[model samples]
Target chain A: MSEELDTGFFADWLRAAATAIDREAAHLTELDSPIGDADHGSNLQRGFTAVQTALAKEPQETPGALLLFTGRQLISTVGGASGPLYGTLLRRTGKALGDAAAVPLPELAAALRGAADAVAQLGGAAPGDATMLDALYPALDALDAGSAPGDAFPAAARAAAEGAEATVPMQARKGRASYLGERSVGHEDPGAASTALLFEALATAYGEGA
Target chain B: MAGGEQVGIVLVSHSSEVADSAAQLARELGGGEAAPVVGAGGAAGGGTGTSSERIAEAAHAVDSGAGVALLADLGSAVLTVKSLLAEGDQLPEPARLVDAPLVEGAIAAAVTASGGADLDAVAAAAEEAYQYRKV
Candidate 1:
C-alpha cells in the first residue's frame, strides 16, 4: 500500500484479469444470454488471453506502457462493445499515467476515475445506466475513501461486487442490454458482472505484489 | 474538398459478409464512380464481432485527404468505430462515425461523397438518411 505499483504490478494485474476472465467466462455468457448477444464472456476471455500472451512475449518498460499495450491488445482482439469500451478505459488510464516507472495506488485510482469518466462520455452512459460504469464508479469511490490504505483493494472489490448485483433490479439504458427495454430488468448486467471480476482481479493482484 | 475524388466510405458490420455487401450496395448505387468503399467486419480471429483493427485499416485504405465517413451495423459495431475515432491515429485527417441506419445511410453517404462532398457533408448526408421512410 505504501509502495508504488510498477510494471510488474500492472503485468500481474492483467494476468490475474486473464485468469479470472477465463474462469468466469461461461457465467458471463449466461448473464448475457438474456439481454445481450451472449458473447461477453467469450469476448473478454479471448481478449485477456491475448493480453497475457503479449505480456509473456514483450515486456513494457513502465506501468503506462504495459497498460497501453494491454489496452491495444484488448481493442484489437476482443470483438463487440467491450473491445472499445474496456480498451478506452485501459488505454486512457495508461495514457494518463504518462510513461511512469511506477504509480502510487491513489494515483492509479485517480487515473482510472478519469478514464472511467472518458468511457462514460464515449458510451453516453451515466452511473445508473446498468453498465460497467455501475461497478467501476462504486469501486473507485470506495478505493480511497478510508484511512487504511491497505484496506482499499478489498473494499473496492466488495463495492464492485455489490454494484454489480445492484444492476439486477435496474433496467438497462446502455449497451446491447438496452435494446431489451423494460425486459432488461431482473437480470444482472453482464458488463457490470465482468467489471466486478476486474476489481477482484485488481485486489488479488495487488495483494500478490503486482 | 471539391477535387471530385470523393471522400472515402467505410461500412462496418458484425459479419464480414454483411459489411462487404453493404459496401458493394453503396458502390452499386454510386454507379461505380463513388469514393473508395471498404468493409470492416468481424473480430481478428474470424468470428462475429466488430474489430477496430479492421475498421482502422478500412478507414486508412479509403482515405484520400478528403476524410472518411464510417457507418456501422449495430451495437458494438458503432462503439468500435467510435473508439477508433477517439484514438486519433492519423486516420485521414478526419474520420467520423455517423449516427444513422447502416444500409440507407451508407448509400446516401456514398452518393454524396462521390459528388466530392466534404467530411461534414458526407456525415450530414448519412445522418439525413435517418429521416428517410420507406414503410
Candidate 2:
C-alpha cells in the first residue's frame, strides 16, 4: 500500500466524518444547549451532508481539490461559527496540500497543524478557551509525535477525544459561550466534541486503509 | 462622491432585520450615491446565523472595483467574511475585514465610502468607530 493518501482516502475520510457527525449530532447539540446556541449538531450535519452531496455530484481529482470543495460546502451550508471555523480549517489545509494527488504522513501532519493554527487565528481563541482548539491542538500534538503517517491518525483521535472531555472544566473566552462567563464551566464544549469526531473519522478512514 | 470610485461596504450579521436596518441607517447617514452597501445576513432558512454564500453574493453585488470593506456583528460573521476573502481568485482585490462595532462601524465606513475614499481609508474609518464614546 502507498505511504501517502490519495483522493479516494480523502473521500472516505469525509464520508466517515459525515456519518460520525450524523450519529453524534444530537449529543453535540445537547452539549451546546448549555453554553452555546444548541445547534452544533444540526449545523455540522447540514454542512457535512452538503459536502457529501457535492462530492457525489462532482468527484474531485486531487485530495486538495476534494478538501477545498468540502470546505466550501461547509462554509456555505452551515450557518454558525463552526461552519467558518471548520471550513477555514479544511480549506487552509487543502491549500497547504497544494494540488497533491497523494500526501505523505508528514505533509498531512504539517497541513493539519496549519489548518488548526488558521482556525485559532480566525477565531482568536487560544487553548483553554473551551473551543475546538482544545481538541484540535492536542490532536495536532499527537500527530506531530507520531513517527509514521499510519501511526498518527489513531493517536490523534485518542488525544482529541481526551481533549474534548478536558473542555468540560474550562471557561470559554471566545464565541457566544464566552458571554456566559463563569457559567460556561461544567459543560463540555460542543466545538471540541465535534472536532473529536473529525479526528475519529480520520482514524477510521486510515485504519481501514491499513 | 467628487473623487475616484467609492469603496463598497458589506454588513454581516446573524439577523436579517439587523443587517437590513443597519444598512439602511448607514446609507442614510452617507446620503444618496453612497457607495453601494449590501446586507448579507441570516442563515438560508433565516433565524440567527450567518451564510457565507449570502456574504459572497453580497460582496459581488457591492464590488465596484474600488474594493470592499466588511463589518460583521459577531464571531461567525467575521469568520465567514474572512473565509470568503481567503478564496484567492473568487473575491476582488483590496478587500479587507475591519474589527469594529458593527452598527457604528458600518455607518462610519459607509460615510467614508460615499466620499469615494480608498479601501484603506474606509477600513480605517470603520476601525476608528471603535473609539467613539458617548459618555
Which candidate leads in lDDT? Answer: 2
Off by over 4 Å in 2: B1-4
Candidate 1 error regions (>4 Å): B1-4
Ten residues in a row with the worst lDDT in model 2 chain A? A144-153
* Model 1 C-alpha lDDT per residue in residues A1-210, reported as the tens digit of each score: 447778877888888888899999999999999999999999999899988888889989998888788888888888979988899999999999998888887888899999999989988999998999999999999977833436788899899999999999999998778888999999999999999999998889888772
Candidate 1, residues B1-135: lDDT per residue as tens digits?
A: 546667899999999999999899898896556778889887777878888778888988998888888899887898888877777773667788888888899989988887787889989989999998889
Cα lDDT tens digits, model 2, B18-50, are 998999899999966677887888998789899
Candidate 2 lDDT tens digits, A43-124: 9999999899888889999999888888888988999989889998998889899998899888988998998888888888
Q: Give the fraction of reference interface contacts each candidate recovers.
A: 0.82, 0.92
| Predicted complex 2: DockQ | 0.83
Give the clashing pairs for model 1. A9-A210
* CAPRI class of candidate 2: high
Query: Candidate 1: what lDDT?
Result: 0.87
Deviation from native of the Cα of residue A39 in model 1, angstroms: 0.9
